[model samples]
Target: MINTRPRLAWHRARLLTIGVAVWAAAAALLTPVAASAAVDNPAPTPLVSFTFDDGMQNALTQAAPTLKKYGLTGTSYVNTSCVGMTTVPNTCRASTDVPYMTWDQITQLQNTYGWEIGSHTVNHLCLVSVGDDCQATKLTAAQVDAELANSKATLAAHGFNATAFAPPYGDYDMSVLAQIAKYYSSMRGFADTGNNPWPLGDYLIRNIPVQERTTPVATLKARVDEAITNKTWAVFTFHDIRPSPSQNPDDYQYGTAELDQLAAYVQSKVAAGQIKNVNISKGLVNGSPNLLANPTFNNGIGDGWRTDAPSTITADIGNTGSFPDSARSVKMVSGSAAGHLFSPKVPVTAGTNYLFKSFLNVAAISSGEVGFYVDEYNAAGQWISGQFRKRENTRWVESMNFTYTPSSTSVASASLQVYVTGTGITAYLDNVQMLALAAGSTPPASVNLVTNGAFDAGISSGWTTDSASTIQADGANRGSPANPVNSVKLTATTATRHLFSPQVAVTPGTYKIASYLNITARTSGEMGFYIDEYNAAGQWISGQWKLGVSAAGVTNVDLTYSPSTSSVAKASLQVIVQGNSGLQAYFDDVRWTKS
Candidate 1:
């Protein structure tokens, strides 16, 4: 087996023996000089945290003993909903088997083995692709919310206090991470390069996968040795622990011999006091960013900025030729491998909000946009993208601020960049800053109500279908001008018409419309909403808008259009149903807004 030493100061110590016989080749190749240095001064030992996911039975019956034999601690994330929920014990046919452990078994393992339990999100879903967790379809945003909040309640009820979460499918984008971080202290995901053996803390940590195709026991031992030598924690994650494992598609079973070998290696480390089993979250708090010792930014005035990555510097004129002060517009002529420069790491608390600011300028030679982005990572090495960018004209300095609510990590770090887009506009930036905000003081804004239904009070804020069927408010906040509605629906025996328009011309711009409604049946006709506008001729332009429905009750629908439709003097928002059939039904709460 090829065993590589860890990256650390060149150091070495006497070959400490605890158990297994030393291979002649391995021993001879050992650097005596390096061992001597380690004996003189050892590097700070790092904390190791082990976490497992998808509680396979084999993990408990097979892997547990091995882990225990090594005096190691492990946390397993489980899907509570999967317990006793299916008759079929295994669903192992897919390329990757996705199965859940029975609650009874999971409880037994946790209670008897001192294992930490965490939620895997109920109904396991990809939250980023979908919008809100409650209202999404396959797994509605509501369902996702229920999965997280309800699972917590269930675990607590069952005496399991789970404070971490492993996003379902190991698939998450910035938006999903933002939402999930709201609930979990530590989030786990699949392994990635530069993320293996994961980092510690609330942010993305590392976990190495142990699969069927993994290297043999000897190689695994060598790697473990290297990790110990470097004082690095190596977490080995697997799905199952059995030979020729069946039924579980994701099973990465180990033979009895391999398990014994791992146990022995762990025993040696414990005997030598070379290893300490610790919780993953604790590791993050203890690990510190490798800050640059003499970070400098050439592009800023007086070189006041410090960044780990290289930055571009350019020259210009401003305060230099003026009376008050000497100011030269310094531009970062280029970006580095790490993107832009950021301040040294600062401690942050989860559940709290924070504001980060940086000074930037746009030069006359450049144009387009000049802005910044917030960069954060999750336990799985996933980056959490921030919102909004600051723009400036070619004239002066501007401050860009990013505000966010943190999750489990104690300190969240960010990078700031002053970039110019388009053409003929170059910008200089400096004085980047970050500040934590108090919770509940303010939250990101949300869309509460939108409507085109405008009518004078007490004048029947309903729809008038001239010569057809007229509609009135239900007086229960339904279809009322004052009370924004959600759905608009009506049931009538004959053909009906309604006059619908925003008391004011609908604001001109690209907009989206959403509402819910249903009809008893559209046996021989079509059901749809309508948008009315006017052409150069000052005549109303009507377009057929339709949304299909599945069953009874309210069917929510969303539509989009350009501002040109509402830019005219008397343009409006209208919903129309046209056909020769009777028993027409219409719905309300129709709203038009931007995405």
Candidate 2:
């Protein structure tokens, strides 16, 4: 029975009384972190947004109270067709029982509870799905357009902003979206259950459905637990919630206690600053590359963040407008034991610089040091190292920025976290972001894979070739004539001529196909290299080709490629120097590396 603390610094000072105890040792010992998670899929943050589709009356009566008790809010989708028309009470069939929300009740939830109202459609139209909430008629694009547009217009007309849509039966095509795109900001779709990656398609947000009879309370908690652990985004969909066992209950409907349990868990994590329960519209807003989702804490306590376990730290939202342009910022109060607040993991490119900035306002955080860091992890999902950013607890007047560079290409995700130490720590963080520096920034380290890379061992078993070309030991054109030659010269007379490397085994990382080309002579045609990939079973996956040329001196020609499981583990590298019959080329250190 963990009790949540009040959300503001001032309120906690006067009203602080109770605290909850937890089995911190047992929890940490049992749970192991997993890698292979889709890295920084969305704007970082483990967000779990709740949405109720089909305008059911139970949303207001049974669901709303449970949500409010847990200090939670959600977006509920409605279709204008059955806004108020519900079945008579005391029935026992899907066709005979259950109730639909009236327009008044829907408005009350929006106006009174700060809940978002989204469009389902003018009708619950489905193009393919044959489930509940499906409008079986194969609607035309124009018909779908009208349904989407009219519903959005109606909700707006009634004072609901109605920015996002929840497709009935999770059915929609590009044509349907292109039309709806005219009026809505984003759309919530069923089936796909995970975070909405940036540039956030806005057209199709994924969701997971939950029910009392099917999705147990423990399962619901586990789903959110995974999202929190991975720092990913997820949306949960639900329907009716009745007090007692419903004989003819729809699989989508839930019992009150189940909903209560789920809500209570959300509240606990939110109070601990572990995750965010946001509305779909939050992701659709002016998509940018900055990761750290819900940085402002607008989604309440649970929006994808976490603090220490079994600790006396209390967390909640607070109005920090006194700090200039402040909105809603998270407020955490430290008890005797020092606590930490960890941010969601953000994916980054190795050797690339990432810029991070954040705004902080403190309330009497005297004495102890406030620490900021970049916790880096490898592709295996294990914490490899950490980079310190801010070691001072300096009071911020406005904002601060920090930049860090990862050391290896195998680096997967980097999460931001802050440690508070000292007497009575209380603070708020707002407007934070972590962005990957664009290409043409600091360069990555390169690795050479060509055996006898300098050809010091002479033209040998490493390179396979066609009859059109041959490698000769050259001493004169290697970088300059002065040095003893360890380089090989490739002279190609035909298009099929190439010096190919044996199959190289690779893991997931960036690779460069590079060669030192000193073309003493050039005439017709193009000179290039190609990389062909193969799966574990020796099946061809894909290939890419690029060309380079320089008349005199030496030209360092190179290109990079990243391999995935989709392309398998083996790659064949080929170097082709094609031109006129006397087209001469020099090859020194040809390499492919994880850098």
Candidate 3:
């Protein structure tokens, strides 16, 4: 291993000295109060932060130039300890070289080209699983501490202000977050982009992880458009660069053309002033405005009709459709802005199906279309190809459905919009919903995946639970805000029974199954997961399960299972938290990924 530590440390120290000077310079150049004000919802489209992981050298050679050409900006999370190490020998399957982005290269990208730097830990272990035992196996607390402090110090030394981190392998639990919050202001976690308005309210931000290098640019755009429509802040996590002279090829690295296409899209958005391209940390600093907190609309609902944006209008409730109580509809009350509504700009993964629906007053105009779109960006915001969904006839009972997919997964953001292009067809919409369909696995047998679920007497639009399941608000918080630990335990019992599966659309493929569980006891109770094979006739062929040892804590389990040879097009994931312990268990983040 080439020990670049001494050189890296020295360079880092020098760079930090200079960075402080530059930040001081930049600070001096700007009116300090102006900078502060800019953070408070400055004019300009909101920026979508794009981040790449693993700090592979290709980031410099392949990803950076594309970003620079387009004037887009981004952050690359580096594993500092791997700075001077040689490419892990013969073991690398995709490229012959080891995958660490060198300290020296990182400096050039930051100082010369202006790329933001972030920490991926000292040695990139699954930070979430790193307890004392795990730390003892590889690096120590001192080492991990060094990784955290030193990487920040190193970036500062390299003239870059790194204020963010994307946990190694994008894995981190509460304990992992506790350890990280001590060092970084914000961290990135994995997210599903199928639905937008990115998961909010946390130092831990969710991101879309790009694993396929083969995805096309157009497809990438469609996905991005959808994300924006859902008003989601999209983040992309990556590793490896394309066609490198290295051994690790299968790792999620993008080809040069693909990387360029992605970057260009972001740059186009920036050039148009649709968004201000900035690093991930900056996005963290300018967190999305809590629309509800602002004194703009009543009871905290802006409804995409902004005072700042002209073509949009908020109207009084009128009779036309269904759902009578719905009020405050958007009307073409006047001007060129007559049919316009609000939308987002972030992008999403291509080929994914998304469902969008809204509650509207029955009196509003009978029908119209909701528009969904996305804009892809590079390090600089730029335009790349994307997709959109146009829903035609609106139903009085509810909102219309508009769904689409981009040709690329590399888009930066998307937009969800509604317009009354037709005359005299005004609509009143509320309780809008955007749901990302689960991909990667077929559903298991014997479990009816619930849609728009009700559990513990509370409801979420896209969740699943037994409609027949009875809820008992054991305490005063039956539906009260306090003591919200209500129970609606599944009543089904058989040789084996399962509950809780969300709307999952699956094609035939091998998949990896996983879910998050909150166990109430540390006993033999296990959450049994299954992969069922149900034919068109609703007949079950076979399925498999892995009994996870349940404990009274939030634990995410990755199940070991595969699909049967026969084509099982439609399936549901089955979960049964069964055991004599009689402890309550809650589930979240159920995932089925095509391997």
Candidate 4:
């Protein structure tokens, strides 16, 4: 609702008038000639940075731990005067009381977690008033110098060499930029919503805020995707990380779980080598390196792997090919005890998260289970702990991934293993991978599994109607404005008839099914959506029928369905209508997405 256009335009104008020379000089010193390519030119590698403002205490207690779980570190911009304050400081625009991180805590963030410490002025003063309080533009040039120079000095006194700056409230003008350039290498702006180009505008570095309530995890992932596609740097700003965030947007609070989810998503991208997560000081870098050697077993199992139980576990470099890549796979057979295939010992940092993944094929498992685990060791090579990550008790073929953070700081190394624990279990494992996560990682985004859900190509594209009903695409009545030019209209006889969508392949997870329907006419019965489940063998097993509605107007049909059994490997969305001869309805914009 707030118009920030005039302020942004003015900011740009001032940058050209007063900050251009400073920015050009800094760019020449920092960026290479090759880095000044066209904005459309893709970056060699996409970069992302997690940055926090105002040095909130939760940035240490909550945000740091969450980011560490994904093996990530962020930049924390601290207001020197606000450090250790239990009440809202007069320099801060915020009205509510919130604790700020202490000097010791900030040091730990830098020394222990490898986070970058940045300046946020001596007092949280807005350089120029846009609309909020704490405006300091009225103050003399000497005061502004103290705000900038003094804050950097304080950080230096505390043994932190701060190099980045973020203007409070993103309120700044030409004078502010000139002063900021004197104190820091880069300055981040609050309202700049898009990713930064290869040769960044260091003086006004753009960032997207991770606000609670308004900003969803999906939106953040999209930003990451955009950066990867455009080959740019994506910086996200955060404030308080709380277990229960206030609904007020002014609080600038986000839930801890949401942060974890975003972190997981970013970690997944890092694992896939789509983007590199870095701090503000580190412009761009390579992504997380794959720790496990010979992940595909292409060079032979002896390269970096050994069988713990040689009698039951064998390296099958022939015949059995690896998943995703045509290489080699290892096999394990259950014996009296578990058989283990251990990867080479990988050095691990304490309190940092790691992701282990492998594709597995269970040919047969009559009684027991096959598990993916990690065995931890201390610096002295003594066994510290063994963690059971994930397992499969049934016959299935899929990729299994699990994240693990060393429980004890003493843990120095880990060996990933695939073991068969049950009797008569035979499984093939391939394409094993282990990568350290950046701090604050989350799971990957899910996709819509429904085929031709919008009926764009016509009813026969991916739908089948029972003999008792006739289905046709209706362009005139598309059910909703968001829908495409066509919606499938089903007219059924006195008998109940069903129009079914193409069978969608699925894994073991929750799915959301939604569709818009318009019941133009109906005489006796109701109409709604149903999800029919199928086993791995493509045999119909069961179904979940939603409560049918008989209203003769546009209605939304939504349902959340999870597999009732592990065998459910496929599902189909069924639009069922039962009534008299005149039963007619329209269905459009059907969607089936993993939740």
Candidate 5:
């Protein structure tokens, strides 16, 4: 067994290891490969979660109805002390003028619309002062504990099981996280500004804030696209939904029209089986604890971890690397003697499936292999059996994920062991996660609604040009590097040229339009992109000019648009170049898809 040490000593060692140069070199060679592997392995399904904060009245009146119309649900984080208040309390971080939801109304969100109710502390006290409205004073340890425990208790009193928490102003530190872990299963933060990766950091769940004017419908749909492509989870944070929201971001309010558009876009993706729209709790898998303490190596070795042949293992190896959620990883410098790192034994059920995952950066492997195994223990704490889950032999950097189930019903607990054998093999491991694999359905294939989007055949294949311009296939001016094909080149003189795409059949839902353009030569005016709407009789009903660009370089433009009227049955993409004279441009990779 490996020896344990105090956390203070481990922190000092971690600080000492920060100056090591080898870790930086290994990370440089390993980070990109790890990122590429994450994109390549699409096993984790994409998820989108809509979460509202402060329990504002509009959450029930506006957000819930819009979400329900699309068969989607959301999570509402409420401040228990401010419920039904006409004015916000000074202790709370919410707007002073906005009204909060009544307890009964909050119940409707849970029982009627199927939304999850989470905690936002009792008085919305900031755990750490970070220069925000909630940061008037820093709370003591006792105050923090009371805020977490009492809010959860209050929710339970109202028949709500609040497992997730969002701190006021997203203010928190390691101390706050410790207290949060004691009371909540997950913590959603403000301004985290990206999608959450799979095997999510339950306590540090990140979110993208949606504010009025700043957050466009296109931006929200693009986030959904990112989740789909990366196979990650996207949590959108909203504070208030109003009929006429103030444009100031400080107000933290969003318009109902834009909210409806975003909801419709999410529904389209759900309908196409590209993403699953879930509440906060439903999005989390199993809610199981990561049995390995100090899994990320943030506290260095000898903290809930031990190794045979300590000379071969280096803790707190990397400080600046693509280590997920943390800046450190453990390094193994192996020789002919095999070195083994062991995790603390954690209780496990006999028939349950467990997912063991770790990000590995193998800088060099000359003669041996790195293996991950699960060692099973009996009820009497004796080693019973072991299973070799996965091994890496070549120079590689990727996430190693394997599912292990105990062979016998007598297996009581298990410990994860990573062993490196052979000569001259050096590897770094980080973010080791072991939890039960949640049950889920397989994702369906995604479809693109536009055809001949790359202009592969010719300009006339699936495109039309108006009388003001002459369109020809240009092999020299392509916009997309991936396509690498002929693009439609429009030449016009002092007149607006219209290049129309094939009409795509439409429904009363939001759609995303994308195209790449390069204004090779221009004299006076800019190029415009529009979505033309047509009624069932093929008559033009409405058209929205989305964007216009005049720069003499490659420009990628994409926007989300919903039909103005229900009578519209078809829509077409229009690319127009209006200039004085001698105008030339290339357009390629036009895409219109149900968002």
Candidate 6:
């Protein structure tokens, strides 16, 4: 095993360095008064601080590059005793997880990237009194004193100006706080699902854990959006900056793509001035003015945007069908195959989240795609990462709204690229937007497999069902978020009841069956959906599969089945219900998607 990565070794340091609080709080932990949102202070806008806990080397190799590239900084709380040691010699912590950062790298972050250095206890002691980790038995007061003092001392001795302390494991109490406050300006913790509304007190700084596998990009964006809307600060805690390694990947580890995607969005949002990006100290500041030079496309294309070479495409400042107030937009025509229009470099914050949108009207014959692209770069001015995309409609499509994300942390700038397979195709682009994403609607499902899937025809037109069932198109309670107006309800008592669909055309391939089942009530046996295949001879060729639902409130009915046999002539879908008396079920959005 390559033990080179930092293991957050503090958990193993134990009571060896109980050195008392002699680091002098006034000299080491006094936060600069210049930063916004001091204790109990309010700011005009919300602030979000990006912070990494533990001394992983990836913090430098992986995270710092993006952070520095985006003109952003972060705070990494590390255990001093394990400093520079790939794996600490002795401690309760696992050997594989004890790779602490070298003092050299720590200094590099502070001196080079404006990153804040913070303490996380001498060696991740369980704060004796809180008594959570490191052993069932709590450490003595003397031991706790030694851990805190020695930890801060190590950072101070190594030329690191650490102003905050993150209590290891997010565990702390009034007893721990009283002690920590004497040696630190603030102590960061991971206790809240939401952002912390400041002035954050000296103790209990809240942080959301952006674990790789558990938290999604959409989820992080929502948190940042919440901070922006509520005027609160969002502080984050991370462990391994890189993705889960092939060997012994823990929940604390996430893929670089996830981090990069998040960082790219943060940088974009920061550039837009939609939210304030800060290090640990400045994390509670008022927001800044929008950083965009020509957000509304009012200055004309030449004013700010950088277009492709003139030979391949033609472009001009256009006003036809423009958005309100902004009487102008950029119009482009491809003489050959493809063309691109780009924006000036937009500085971004690393490890952040954002949403983007654009209003466009495309016209004339088209064959290729027209979407946005991001040119990514690192702080050292090296191109690093990016993403490109186009809306589905490029042929005679107009007055359309395009929504997307930069999709990479290294995304340094965005561009509008139009590709037309057909020569002489024209596209109208306007009001390119880089905005925050609010809690949006759930995405619609894919094309369904079964026809008359919803029975919106007011009746089960081509469907076959036992005479006991009926389609309830009336506004009775049979409704789901997906299909609110139509459903086929079945009430069964003793005898089994089934609703089958007419035989549909089939080919040798895989198909997905998805439906929603809502049980008004159930003493359940079972109600399910099924797929059956028959050969050309009109006889069952032994291809059958089923998925069932047993509970209430709209249970998901989804499964994948394949009639791989070329002999398949046709296929039929059915819903069968059986069980005790008085079992009522409503099913809707019955779809069979072919892949």
- TM-score of decoy 6: 0.40
List, residue by residue over 513-579, the lDDT tens digit for candidate 3.
5443445443454555555556556555555544545445434344544456555555555555453
- Residue pairs with colliding backbones in model 5 are none
Residue 385 Cα positional deviation in candidate 4, in Å, after optimal superposition: 66
What is the descending TM-score order?
Answer: 5, 2, 4, 3, 6, 1
Task: Give all candidates' CA lDDT scores.
Answer: 0.45, 0.60, 0.45, 0.69, 0.70, 0.56
Q: Which candidate order results from sorting by lDDT in descending order?
A: 5, 4, 2, 6, 3, 1
* Best lDDT among the predictions, by candidate number: 5
Work out the TM-score per prediction. 0.39, 0.47, 0.41, 0.42, 0.49, 0.40
Against the true structure, candidate 1 reaches a TM-score of 0.39
Highest-scoring model, TM-score: 5
Off by more than 4 A, model 1: 1-44, 47-49, 85-87, 90-104, 128-143, 193-201, 246-257, 286-595
Of candidate 2, the 10-residue stretch with the lowest lDDT total is 8-17
The positional error of residue 490 in candidate 4, measured at the CA in angstroms, is 67
TM-score between candidate 2 and the true structure: 0.47
What C-alpha lDDT does candidate 5 achieve relative to the native structure? 0.70
- Hey, what RMSD does candidate 2 come out at? 21.3
lDDT of 6 at 482: 18
Which parts of model 5 are misplaced by more than 4 Å? 1-43, 87-92, 130-132, 287-353, 357-414, 418-595
| Tens-digit lDDT string for candidate 2 (1-595) | 1012111100000000012122122111111222222223223466777788877788898888889888888888887776767666623222235677778899888877667898888866674454455544567767776887688778878777787777776776544544554466566777656655322444567777876666788888887888788766668888667787454435567788888888999889988999877767764423245566666656643445666632533344444421222446656455554556666666666656665666544555554445566667776556665554454344432234555677577777766766565565566655566655544343332334546544556666565655423656665635311112556677766443666666777768877555445566666544556666678876667665544453453454446766646556787666655536567766664555555
lDDT, candidate 2, equals 0.60
- Give the range where candidate 3 is weakest over 10 consecutive residues by summed lDDT: 8-17
